[model samples]
Target: METSDNATAAEETTPEPERTGIAAQDWATASAVPQYRAAVVDLLGALAYGELAAFERLADDAKLAPSLEDKAELAKMASAEFHHFERLRDRLAQIDAEPTAAMEPFAKALDDFHHQTAPSDWLEGLVKAYVGDSIASDFYREVANHLDSDTRSLVLSVLDDTGHGNFAVEKVRAAIEADPRVGGRLALWARRLMGEALSQAQRVVAERDALSTMLVGGVDGVAAGFDLAAVGEMFTRITKAHTKRMAALGLAA
Candidate 1:
């Protein structure tokens, strides 16, 4: 009877392995380090919510589509965004975190970004999908590099551009070809998107201590943190990438 009791007690006492997509050893290492764990949770939370919001926005954009084909494409993209969100949500759960709670902190900032940059037309939606999302993806990639290998891989994978790239580029470029003046208008709109994105991003950094620290705190001591010089250089690289993306769309930066 005592042996039976001991066996059951042992089973109860042994901790369950975490269910995150990353390796168990990696999860253990991240959990052992306070800053690393907090940063990872904060980053994943923000990204998961971002994808969920993107899914909704893309679905809304589908309603404004000019044709059945375009609406179908938008719906497909929205579905992909939801898949990404599911992956992130599962990853969060594996770590015993509440997916909705993790997502709550970022809701306002991301919603504000979309609200402030609401597209005026189908063309604007396409451009915003490509340009605005690309910038956000670039920033996420930059931060992912600072994470552990498994976590970094998961982050990059979820950040995948999906299947809308060539579609947006081709459509926007064709529109520019049809009306040269549209390029000028889009260029201005793109600039506004960039500006608003930067504003909201700065606000996010200012408000989220763990995330902002992750930017400058050097998670796991793997990459440079956010100092003034570092921040300036970061924006410089983002600007260069933005310019290239605009050029691809046949618009001025």
Candidate 2:
């Protein structure tokens, strides 16, 4: 999982912040706009449900672990994911939004994504947890740039690594080295995850009008907006990060 200095630099560099046109504002200022409030609720709801789902998936995947040590590691990560879900749920309630109602709209889409991409073995499960979760985290971090400062901090906090990244990289690279053919299978699996993950994201945005509008048109006068071209660039950045992650796992992207 060694990252070259060049790769680290590239990872650190992002498109200019000015392009987002979003000025930093607190939740009080940003949420005063009804549309913005609704958008924030929807965003939090989707995130809350995603974290909950991650907790469940990690716990279930732990059963497929080849050793007790691996099982324990995943259990710890699962607990962390649940805590993240709790934070998002509490945040929604604190804002006077009903957590269940906010999350309901996202349930089917997220559930379908998991059902479709269920991993077949321990290594595949590890790849799913690492690759799938990282993609979602990257997308959220990009969107966080447009959010009010308070919400942005909460979003970023919940997206923290939870120590799974290095664990997955170590185990997956070792598995590949022990049997090089595993690399081909995992590389393909990672690609499938990339495609499904991106599609699920697009589906969510298309179905959620307030959230989509928030991204495309900006919320109220407080936030700047993303043009269609900017959205394209966002996905490009996500794709590049995915490639780097694949490389870290000793797989071809």
Candidate 3:
């Protein structure tokens, strides 16, 4: 996986998606295709619903930010999540599928993931959005290569435009460094968030392997087979990114 450190990459990626409204039937598929049972479908539903809630909740939380600068940036990011959620929901519909109901089975476990790991402060919120969303975007970007073209395009589109979330990365790190005391508290909070995330993921497997099986399909190795490790690695990178943010802020990692 190649990583770019330049802001130009950020600039190149964030073209405003022209807001042509979703097609009349974009939210529902026409033919009753069998692909509905695939782990892929279930995963999409889980991801779709999560994005819907994340967008709303994050938008609300942005109000908690101290400055209009932070508030505006975070709100933009939250709105983008809503765009992504709708794109996914519309794509699900085009498959002639039930978006919310398909998403229902995995809802509780996924909701539990967010509820248990909710952030407590402004910097933490930025880290959660920057680190968390970017990691998920990367992993989904990778997984998209395995899917059919339309689904792949839909996934790629949703993952495409993260307008300088890396900027937030730089800002948060600077904030933490400017005040060394926040380092331990935010770092500890980051770990707690990751732990709750992992625990909820395991519970998903223990209780809802149907969705789990649908998520990974037949990836390859035992560790990769129906395991949450891929998602965990995403979270691991989130922590690594958080470390970079902290260090940039002049705080100890």
Candidate 4:
């Protein structure tokens, strides 16, 4: 009878694993380590939301394409974006944050950014998609390793492979060869779109601590509050890549 009682007591007292997508141990360790856990969590949450929002925005923009063929290509690009978004959402769930909540803060800012600087024509639409997606892919790839192993693997897996080379430079080059004047205006528009995105991105960061932490979460114990240098490197890589993209397309500045 005492053995039976002991068994029941043991069962009753045993702790269950956490369901928050965060392990209690991992959470406790991460959370207790100053602001490390929250910073990482905030970043994960923000990024997950960003992916979903980009997918939706790109899908809407796809409709503005002038040609049916271009429209279809844009739609395909949007589909790919959603695929990327879903992977992010799944990873977010693993960390115990609601996808929608993660994405809410920058929704309006992202929306307005897209709305205000919407492509004036199909070619411009292509440029935005081509340029934006390329930069985003590169950024994600570089920073993906910063994530814990599971997340690092997840980011890498989602990036399987794609063709920015064909779509951006080749397509843009073909168009330019057809009509050289188009290059100048398209190049100007690309720069402007990039500028707007950068400004609003900073605005969004300034407004959200969670996002800022996530973006610059841990930095060699430099907890001086988010490493601007590391983040700037990501931006620098993006700018350099964009410059290369512009040169390939024969666009000035």
Tens digits of per-residue lDDT, candidate 4, 1-253, equal: 0011211222235464232222223443445454445555555555566566666766776677566876676567667657877877776677676777767765787678778877777678667766655555555555543444455566656554334335556667788899999988998898987777667666765676554554553432345465678778667766766676666667875
Task: Determine the backbone clash count of candidate 3.
Answer: 10
RMSD of each: 13.2, 3.2, 7.8, 14.4
**Candidate 2 overall Cα lDDT vs. reference?**
0.83
What would the per-residue lDDT of candidate 1 be over residues 96-201, giving only the tens digit for each residue?
8898888888899999899999999999998888877877776776666456667777887887657676678888889889889899999999999988887777
Q: Note the Cα lDDT for every prediction shown.
A: 0.75, 0.83, 0.57, 0.60
What ranking of all candidate models by lDDT puts the best one first?
A: 2, 1, 4, 3
Q: For residues 187-214, write the lDDT of model 2, one tens digit per residue.
A: 9999999999999998887777667767
Q: Which of the two candidates, 1 or 4, achieves a greater lDDT against the reference? A: 1
lDDT of 3 by residue, 73-136 (tens): 7678778788888887887787666898868877887677667667777777765655455444
Cα lDDT for residue 171, candidate 4? 69
Reference-based TM-score of each model: 0.86, 0.91, 0.70, 0.74
Which pairs of residues have clashing backbones in candidate 4? 43-214
Better of 2 and 4 by lDDT: 2
Alpha-carbon deviation at 26 in model 3, angstroms: 18
Residue 7 CA error for candidate 1 (Å)? 57
